[model samples]
Target: MAPKAAVLVPCLLSLLLPFSSLALTQDICVANLLLPDTPSGYPCKPKPAVTADDFHSMALAQAGPTLAPFNTGLATATVKQFPGVNGLGLAATRVDVHVGGVVPLHSHPEGSELLFVFKGSMTAGFISAESNEVYVKEVREGELFVFPQGLLHFQYNTGNETAVGFAAYSSDNPGLQITDYALFGNTLTAEDAREQGHLRRKIGGDEAQGLLRIAEILKLIKVFFGLSAVPPDGRQDYRCSLLWTCGV
Candidate 1:
């Protein structure tokens, strides 16, 4: 009888082990990332198969290339190339801006962005025409800043050494709208782009183009903010939609 009992106990333990493991992973989430092993890279595997090892890389500690301001913040490991960012819409990595390197004035319309300083100093800000204010702020190592979505913003390296930092965006596919890139490249009118007390200072006139795109983007954004309606006459009444709306 004792020998029979020992064999039965082993079988029972095996049966229960699978159940315990399943219960542990019932509601956990994971991002699948593809890490590059060469000068170029490959793609991500399935998300469920990803280990924590794929999500964290210490490559930012390596010596940087001579690409100057834009080259240092190498995003070769970003969400676009890695599948971990697919559904979450959040991705980040490090940056190294040489002294006097400027990230220039830009905004990410799809989401808010923050830069965490690993080393060095810089200035950052956002300009809101509707709010009629510039939200410029300075930051150094161990500091951070948040730029609200759709606001025009910029960052400049102020450190004697190369400025290094971690940049995180709220979206995996964040749209980078540089103030200067928008105004001059497009066919938008300056008269149509003017704000209450502001005419764009030319970043090749892309600032004007950047501001022009805001009207429609902000309108959609307004809807999510609980604004009742976007008036038909191109005006911002902010009134609750009465009777009906083009929105419905």
Candidate 2:
């Protein structure tokens, strides 16, 4: 009788686990784009206001322009662009890189990224935070690679043809922090930029000095053009010259 009681209790708990999980995830919170966003996500739209259009976007089906310099184009579908994914904790980007092009060094502060390659080939890598070691691989079509959260990573198109890939992030708004732009294109003081952005550790002394000079020049350019120091999306614009010169 005692053995039967133990078996029955274990079986009952196992049966209830799925129901408990389902209950937690059963309801979907569609995003209300007009409302102010909170730390967790945007406020949920009223159920009556929600429509099927909230769940789709034609933007992801088209390819972005791949021009000179970096020769890489990225089309992102985030909560801001696709409100349907609001509070869903997931978003995606379509990346197209021409031969000899690179996605550059960048990090996502809020999410991990999983890259799925569907065309051509590329070399992708990320720096490990625990060991500070670089983990790199040559990935081809039908392969996938992962860049862990908050780690600096990059992808380069190594093949002669174009490379196409999709990156899925763990957050609806995965903040993109490009290494060069963060170091040289923001409102930070030169000293603060160097210290906080780790510019000294990443580049040569001459290069760092050049970047500082360029940053100063860009500040003047912004003032001359009457552009806001920070854009509505909270990211400072990278100067056209900087983008062309750095190939980022």
Candidate 3:
């Protein structure tokens, strides 16, 4: 009986160890956005402090403004805005684009995006980093599209009416890097911008052309920030220049 008890206790300990480990890994971690974000995400909020409201957002139900030059609007729900999503490995955005508007060239460095179109029609595409090849499609209402991680991509309203899309990200805080802003709108020197961005040869050393490109890029930025509108004749040019600047 003594030997049998010893064996039973050891076996029980081994079985319980695995269950404890699983329990530790399965706990949900809500975000504490008041603190600085870490590489993974914000530290978890205390379990006792969490409530139903942490998981809900009324902002998503309202439409964003579309009066800018691009006539585009975007509302994002990330771990910071929706703390319940912290450590959940997911986030989302609502995009609205009037006719001729575009969600400009940008990339998510840490996450992939899945888009579901719900209103009107649009042309969506992503450019491959390895080959600079573009995969484009005309996406209509109820259609879905996936943009892989770290690729530059965009959506443009092609139908006569407004277009709306919902995008889900694979990470709680997917970082966005807009190409034009990163390259031209910031502190990067013109020489460095040309070399790293491969812009010099394309402009053929024409100072006026370079300035024109910068002006156009600024317009796109204004459109994105809802500060300006895309001129009717310039919409197609805007689309072409954006793709070209990225060497896509």
Better of 2 and 3 by TM-score: 3
47-133 per-residue lDDT for model 2 (tens digits): 888788888887669778763346688888988888888766789999998877788789999999999998998899999989999
lDDT of each: 0.56, 0.76, 0.74
The candidate scoring highest on TM-score is 3
User: Model 3: which ten-residue window has the lowest total lDDT?
Assistant: 239-248
Q: List residue ranges in candidate 2 displaced over 4 A.
A: 1-26, 189-248
User: What's the ranking of the predictions by TM-score, best on top?
Assistant: 3, 2, 1
- Candidate 2 backbone collisions, by pair: none
lDDT of 1 by residue, 1-248 (tens): 99999999999988866534221333323333335421111233555676766556554456445432232344434555544444354667566766656665667777677789877777777788697687777788899988776678766665678877777877655667655435433454334555611466543455665676675555544443234254455654322122113222
Order of candidate numbers by lDDT, starting with the best: 2, 3, 1
lDDT tens readout by residue for model 3, 1-248:
99999999999888866434211354667778788877555777778998889888865676677634356888889887888787677899899987777787889997999999988888999999999999999998999999999999988876789889999999877889977667545664444534633464565555655655666566556454433465555553333333333212
Candidate 3 off by > 4 Å:
1-26, 189-248
lDDT value for model 1 = 0.56
C-alpha positional error of residue 132 in candidate 3 after TM-score superposition, expressed in Å: 1.0
The stretch of ten residues in a row with the least summed lDDT in candidate 2 is 239-248
**Candidate 2: C-alpha lDDT:** 0.76
